[model samples]
Target: METNNVLKICPPEDSMKDCKTDIKCPIVNCDKVVFSSGSLRMHLTRSHGISESESDDALKRRIKVDPKVYKEYHCPRNDCLYNINSERHFTNMAGLKQHFLKVHAEKKFKCSKCDYGFGMEKDRKRHESHCGMKFTCTSCQCTYVSVEALRTHCNRTQHQIPEMYTK
Candidate 1:
């Protein structure tokens, strides 16, 4: 004496209105409101701005340099070309040496002065303090190397300096 639920038949779309797909982008809730699951993806790429998060600088054109400077670098990655423009940069042999030692599992560079190590000199320089002599203005966060430089910048600016800020 039990009755099967299948005997009590119901329409397939009896509550299908509430079952509509609400597909949206992974980012912010944009102005565009797409109803279909497939169309939502098309709207995001076509109408709204959406791009892959992957970083790629391979296709970019490298800066030109002198032949003497170009002779220095040996290309850090084995897959990439050995050619590189090393004009004003730090070292010539840095490319190949960096690849052989860094990406290919090379030893690290330890700083003698402190307990720190970096793959690049720029990283080391960034870690160093500014010697309490910043060029930019602390008040308005304006960038300039010296007080005289700041004054020159203020003079050229379209906005007038406030009376209270006069020094």
Candidate 2:
């Protein structure tokens, strides 16, 4: 990324012009006529084609990302890499039943940020959210990953507060 790799990312200028080669955006659905930040308004107007009174959230939800969502399972059962797609298609019911029994039952916790360890990812998240232990933030006073993560955050960010006056 340091050196120019031929392509450069930018917004489109007009409908007649082609996108600059430097831009790496290959998301074909892009409604941009020309690559430029200013084309954002044009994109929303053309792509959504919504009424003026439409709420911003409603118009935005019209586009579905399920088509773009990453796959959840790969079914490592045999040589059958039969891609269990996200859109609800089944390759082998037996394979699916076996997989659920094997994988999901093995562990319970998961990291929200990354695919880290957990007895149960849900349990880990639950424990973090309401463990009842007080956590004083170092970066701010509120945001924290876990009580331990909060401690780490404070330690890393070096948060300090003034001492109250005493008699």
Q: What pairs collide in candidate 1?
A: 72-92, 73-92
Q: Give the clash count for each candidate.
A: 2, 17
Q: What is the lDDT of candidate 1?
A: 0.40
CA lDDT, every model vs. true structure: 0.40, 0.40
The TM-score that candidate 2 achieves is 0.20
lDDT of 1 at 66: 30
Put down candidate 1 lDDT per residue, 3-78, tens digits, no spaces. 2311221112223222223345555666554444434544554555442322112112222323222233333333
lDDT of 2 by residue, 79-100 (tens): 3343332233233333343344
Show model 1 residue runs off by greater than 4 Å: 1-72, 78-91, 94-117, 120-126, 131-139, 142-167
